[model samples]
Target chain A: GAGVSQSPRYKVAKRGQDVALRCDPISGHVSLFWYQQALGQGPEFLTYFQNEAQLDKSGLPSDRFFAERPEGSVSTLKIQRTQQEDSAVYLCASSLGAIIRSKNIQYFGAGTRLSVL
Target chain B: DQQVKQNSPSLSVQEGRISILNCDYTNSMFDYFLWYKKYPAEGPTFLISISSIKDKNEDGRFTVFLNKSAKHLSLHIVPSQPGDSAVYFCAAQHNAGGTSYGKLTFGQGTILTVHP
Candidate 1:
């Protein structure tokens, strides 16, 4: 695809179950980020990946949330033991550069909506 | 505590008119600000951005103004169109060095409705 792509647009999981969401960033992009958006709220940053290195994970709410980008192109966000509060849209974004450049804009993917019942 | 806040939950404007959306942030270290537009079932699309050093940045009909002293920013859309109706988000980043990276702290978005 020409832009960032995310898999499993919708996922329904029972409480205590685990789920994994995938994101395929724009080809050759070096930066990737994951955010979670609850109902009627803005997306909150979760983690960031620069190429294959996980540089920042400060915004992650809990230890149950995990993300990785082994090759720096595709990334995955996994939530363990889902709770009702975990039900939200998980968004993925990618930028071309690692530093703050003049045109470093992050392009987002149509997020994966998760429902924890 | 909410670092970034968009107090107005919604805004309505008529076509061909100007629409202003406002945001405020408590973090003084933030140096980069961005505005994003999102549609239902779609991801947020980048709109405009302004660096803390500049008070204003303009791109076509969209302009973003920053007030460092007030810790506030506003996005102006001139001649609003129906297509511009969507949720707008204000995001801030502290781009000091490697410590901050590009993680964005976003404000609760504002819903903009453009009536034709």
Candidate 2:
């Protein structure tokens, strides 16, 4: 892919339902990042993957949130028992660098808008 | 604790004027700072970035300034355009004895509206 691509650009979920958001990063990009953006706010870091290793997930809001990059190519963010606060845009980005020093611009995908009612 | 903070919620500016957005971080360990511009229906685009080693970095009309002493950083867009109106986010990365290579901590964004 030329840039990061995400699925289900808009999602409306009922309270307590489970929703899965998917992200397909640029081909050969070694770094992947997920973020949550509330209305009128910046994208907050959620999780990151370097290859298949989920090295840092400290930003996940709760245990109910889970993300995985099984093949080091595509990734999924699953939210269990979604709450109203979960209504927001979920963004996924990928960069060329493996680490911060070498990290090029983080190319972002059109995020998935999850609306929890 | 919000290690990164953007106190301004919104700013209105004329299209031709320079727009200044500010950000502050608490952690001194953060070595790099980045600014991102986001549109309504699209993901944020990386506008510019500044490493701690340099106080200023310029790319075209966008310039970023870092002040380690004040724990502050700012983004300046000269002759702002209506297309530049978007929510801008400031981010910082801290890698001190951590397994993470590039973990970004971001602040609540400041929305910039460049009216033509």
* Top of the candidates by TM-score: 1
Predicted candidate 2 versus true structure: per-residue lDDT over B47-69, tens digit per residue: 88888989999999999999999
* iRMSD for every model: 1.1, 1.7
Candidate 2 CAPRI assessment class: medium
Q: Residues A1-117, candidate 2, lDDT per residue (tens digit)?
A: 778999999999999999999999999988899999888767788998888889889889999899999999999999999999999999999988654464566889999999999
lDDT per residue for candidate 1 within A16-80, as digits (tens), equals: 99999999999999889999999999999999899999998998899999999998889999999
Model 1 spans > 4 angstroms off: A98-100
Cα deviation at A32, candidate 1, in Å, is 0.5
**Pairs with backbone N, CA or C atoms under 3 Å apart (clashes), candidate 1:** none
Alpha-carbon RMSD of each model: 1.0, 1.6
Positional deviation of residue A75's Cα in model 1 after best superposition, in angstroms: 0.5
